[model samples]
Target: MSQPELSEDELLQRAGRGDARAFDQLYDRLAPRLFGLLRQMLYDEKEAEEVLQEGFVQLWERAPSFDPERSKAFTWAVMLFRHKAIDRMRMLGRRNRLVDGAVLEQTTLGGSSQAADEALQDAERGEAVRQALNELPKEQRQLIECAFLKGLTHHVIAESFGMPLGTVKTNIRRGLLRLRDLLKGGA
Candidate 1:
């Protein structure tokens, strides 16, 4: 009889133990699905491809810490990829913000009073967002700040705060939902 194929969890476990063949098999099995996910998250083929490659490198380094009792290999891999994608998004956002600030400064210098008025409006909107975030419960607010403003991954936030992963995710989600509602109502 032919031998059965190894399960993803089993393959991951073997990879954790430094089995090169098992790692290759795991990559073959998971890369396509992960690439699809990255494409959807990044909305740019090149960025997705880069993240997929980086995420696999990270996965290899971290796999020895994978705990099957805590979660499946695929779920663990998904989290790693998602974190990488989010980091990429955050980096892009920061770059865009810097470019926008420069543009705003140049416009204010060259344009009429209308540009100044727009900048003032932007400041007011920022204050409103700050106030809205302040209205959240402390736990939710802290988690949100850590994840977004600090650009920390969910796993890092959970570990640093000594909270369960589920709790961290839940708080961030609920906080964002409440912040959205507050913004909409304010607007």
Candidate 2:
């Protein structure tokens, strides 16, 4: 026997009444785009599929509580999918070395691979900074090491390095400016 199709409202009504076929139809309608949504926030394909399945399962479990008059069925499901995507991203973020935590969170929009590539580029730029630090000349580097690495005040660094405070400050500032220009491909 062939299954009869229903309008979205009827599907939601039946789904809310515990109709398994209606739930399956709802999952079929939502799953493909939901996978993409999860995948954008999480670059892992397997994890994205799992989260997509779990979102559908929760929709089944909670469908009875959903009020269609307040929101479209698709709208409700998409919001749940987006929430799960962010939840997964947050779990992944806690494990990674996030440089700009706010930017990382804002950019992981559950949307595109282009954004992911930009985030990777930013991380690469930070790695370049570390490499640049290692290549600094000794005295110039020592000023930075004491001021930033050891968290010492500039005056303390000047006293420790046995230099006029102004000279010590200029060495650190000019060294950093040179490093910035080098990283920008200008030096």
Candidate 3:
């Protein structure tokens, strides 16, 4: 019989242990979805492509620290890429002010108006995610808030909050699973 397909969580765990094949598999599964998200967030194809590349490099560097017990591989990756894309947006915003008038004119002339439609959809989805997060039990919601909203890692959260590492990881895992379910049902 053929080997069973490994879950993304399992693959990520293996990748953390230096399994190149597992890393490749994880990349194949996640890149398209992540790229699409970057496109929506950035609304610039070249910037999205650059952020995607940079995000993957960061992922590989950070893989060894990943704990499947805390969060699913895809969600962890999405957070990483989202942060990268946000940083790119901030940098672009700063640079746009320094550009010549010709550059501004060129961008407005070439830019897609579809970004407005995507922004509306993104806002709706963000509201749904916020509602779902609010529905979580207090402990889970707080832990998730620390992790995602504050951008703290499990270790840092544990240290900062005086909780055991395992407790922090468990709460995050449960909260993320619940949040995923809530988003899917509401979406």
Cα error, candidate 2, residue 53 (Å): 1.3
Please, what are the lDDT tens digits per residue for candidate 2 over residues 24-81?
7877777887888788878878668868877888878788888878988888888988
| Alpha carbon deviation, residue 168, candidate 2 (Å) | 58
Off by over 4 Å in 1: 111-187
Number of backbone clashes in candidate 2: 0
Comparing 2 with 3 on TM-score, the higher-scoring candidate is 3
Question: Cα lDDT for residue 171, model 2?
Answer: 94
Q: In terms of lDDT, which candidate is strongest? A: 1
Candidate 3, clashing residue pairs?
none
Superposed Cα deviation of residue 50, candidate 1 (Å): 0.6
TM-score of each: 0.59, 0.48, 0.53
Relative to the unseen true structure, what is the Cα RMSD of model 2?
A: 18.6
Q: How does model 2 score by TM-score?
A: 0.48
What lDDT would each prediction earn against the true structure?
0.85, 0.74, 0.81
